[model samples]
Target: MIKNIQRTLIELANIHRFVMRFYREVFMPPYEFKEIIRQCYVVGWKSLPLISLTGFITGVVFTNQSRPSLAEFGATSWLPALISIAIIRALAPLVTALIASGKVGSQIGAELGSMKVTEQIDAMEVSGTNPFKFLVVSRVLATTISIPILSFYTAAVGLFGAFLSVNQNENTSFRVYFDQVFDAVTFLDMFSLVLKAVVFGFTIGIVGCYQGYHSSKGTEGVGRAANWAVVMSMFLVFVEEILIVQIIQAMRA
Candidate 1:
């Protein structure tokens, strides 16, 4: 048990060093704008359909589930505001991050792990290419930039789904429902959403890269890298969510 704990601490220290190196390298030289753009397209655009479907379903199901309790208290009219607060401040960002951890995070780990095992990354190094910058920095920056926008999109889609559910039950008009949503959502809520999205994105990207870049030397290692990336990213995301929520609540109080 003690050995396992020590190994975990050592791994965490290595990760911290890796992150620090990323910061040092990211701002120092020839920017890989094209690579970053390509990664953004892959990470953001390709994930949209899944995000949209998930967000819509989540909103619909949550609204439906909550309707009964609200109806019991004759507070059914508060549905739009309630849905808006829940989705914008928490659900949209958290769900989007979790999905990305599973999808994008695993892909990144597998791709990099393959490159590592095949000596592709080493070849790039020998060829005088800054593989870390071209690959790691670009992908990390792509996730950081894409996630907040995706979170916003998720929130919008979710609200629309909630509106549909509410309209079917209460006959609320689109404009009225949206107005109520906006009215209930504050600047703090928007701030929290963006902040959470960016942090989660960074965590996912960095953890995936770290795992894959340092994967063991085997085909089996590639699979392990991808699995570890997903698991670690999700774990860190939840930890960040809890910490950020606590901080935000303290600020609000």
Candidate 2:
């Protein structure tokens, strides 16, 4: 038990060092703008279709499930505001991050892990290249910038799905439903969404890179790195969500 705890602590310390190195390298010299843009396209644009489908389904299912309860309480009219708050404040960010952790995070880990196991990363370093900056920094920045935009897109799509459900059941007009949604959502909610998205994005990117960069030798190690990246990213995302929610609630109080 003590050995296990010590291993965990050591891993955490290594991760902290990796993150600090990233911070230092990110601002140094030749910014890989081209690589960053490419990664953004790969991470952000490639993710849109899945995000859209998931967001729409999530909104529809959540609305359908919540309707009966609200109807029972004669609060069906509050559906728009309720949906808006739920989606914007929590659901969108959480869903987006989870999906990205599974999708983008795993991809990054596997790609980098493969490069590492094959000694491609070593070759780059041996050459005049700053492999960490070119690879890790660009990908991390891509995830960080892309996720907030994706979260906003998810929230919008979710609201649209909710609107469809509400219109079918309550005959609420589009404008009226949207107006109510806007009315209920404050600056705090928007701030929370952006903050959560950015933090989650960073967590996913950093964890994936760390796992891949430090993966063991062999093909099995590549698979293990990818798996660990997804698991760790999702776990950290949940932890961050809980902490952020607590902080937000405290601010609200």
Tell me, by lDDT, which candidate is best. 2
lDDT of 2 at 138: 94
- List candidate 1 stretches off by more than 4 Å: none
Q: Estimate each model's TM-score.
A: 0.98, 0.98
Tell me the alpha-carbon RMSD of every candidate.
0.9, 0.8
Clashes of 1: 0
lDDT of model number 1:
0.95
Per-residue lDDT tens digits for candidate 2, residues 1-253, read: 9999999999989998999999999989899999999999999999999999999998999999999999999999999999999999999999999999999999999999999999999999999899999999999999999999999999999999999999999999999999999999999999999999999999999999998999899999999999999999999999999999999999988
lDDT value for model 2: 0.96
- lDDT of each candidate versus the true structure: 0.95, 0.96
Model 2 poorest ten-residue lDDT run:
207-216
* Clash-forming residue pairs, model 1: none
- After TM-score superposition, what is the CA distance of residue 123 in candidate 2 from its true location, in Å? 0.9
- Candidate 1, run of 10 with poorest lDDT: 130-139
